[model samples]
Target: MTRNLFLANRIREVLLNGKWIANTNFKEQIINVNWEKAVQKIGNINSIAMLTFHINYYLDGLLKAFVNGKLEINDRFSFDLQPITSAEDWNNLVKDFISNAEKFANAVLALDNSRLDEIFIDEKYDTYLRNIEGVIEHSYYHLGQVVLIKKMFDLQ
Candidate 1:
């Protein structure tokens, strides 16, 4: 497979489907979480809803950069999830997260192989490949948290 295809597959594996690594993708983890459980804090850790919004924030920003040719995401606002006070709000967040994840994967797959080595947005941000890999790694990190947090709820 081409490098772009490979990277895109990895993105889907983490965000959508494919159980090779963590055995649970974001779709599986977040889709069924009800609004109450999603927002319920299990300690000092972020809620499932917050983590879902956090990952989607990056995906949406990166996908926009792919289309608009500019990267404008700020880390400070990554976790700024608006109030998901109702089931509709939580459902919309999940919907957007899934939609953006797919769009981001498609954007990666559409890239030319040579573009992977090019700087992403700026030299300080590093190459496209590095940023993509970072997304995968960062996602898995948070996915683990979601899983552990879910398990904690299960034990309660």
Candidate 2:
């Protein structure tokens, strides 16, 4: 497989299914989480719902960049999650996350390997390969947080 395809698969493995490093993926960790517990905070840490939103926030930004040739996300506002007050709200957010992640994986898979080397919309940011890999790393980072928070909630 081409390098871009490899990266796309890695993104899918981390965000959707087919785990490599971590046995549990983001989808597996969050899909069965109770909405009430998802919104609960452990001490001052971010809730599971907040972390979910934060991870998807970057995915959404990158998706826009890929499609529009510009990155228009505000880093400061990326963590500003809407209150997930009900099961329906949390379910909708998770569905959106899954849909966006699938769209991103497909977009990456469609790119030629050489396109990974091209600058991503702006020269200030890294190439598409770097950004794509960064997203995978970023997702794993927060996925750990979600797992730990879920464990904490379970213990409580």
The top-ranked prediction according to lDDT is 1
Compared with the true structure, all predictions reach lDDT values of: 0.94, 0.89
Candidate 1, superposed: residue stretches over 4 Å from native: none
Report the Cα lDDT for candidate 1: 0.94
TM-score of each candidate? 0.98, 0.97
lDDT of 1 by residue, 27-122 (tens): 999989899999999779999999999999999999988888799999999999999899999999999999999999999999999999999888
Q: What lDDT does candidate 2 reach at residue 106?
A: 93
Per-model tally of clashing residue pairs: 0, 0
Cα error, candidate 2, residue 21 (Å): 0.6
lDDT of model number 2 = 0.89
The reply for model 2, stretches above 4 Å from the true place, is none
Model 2 Cα lDDT, one tens digit per residue, 4-123: 789889989999996679988899998998899889988999988898898889988889888889899988988899888899999998999998989999999988899999998888
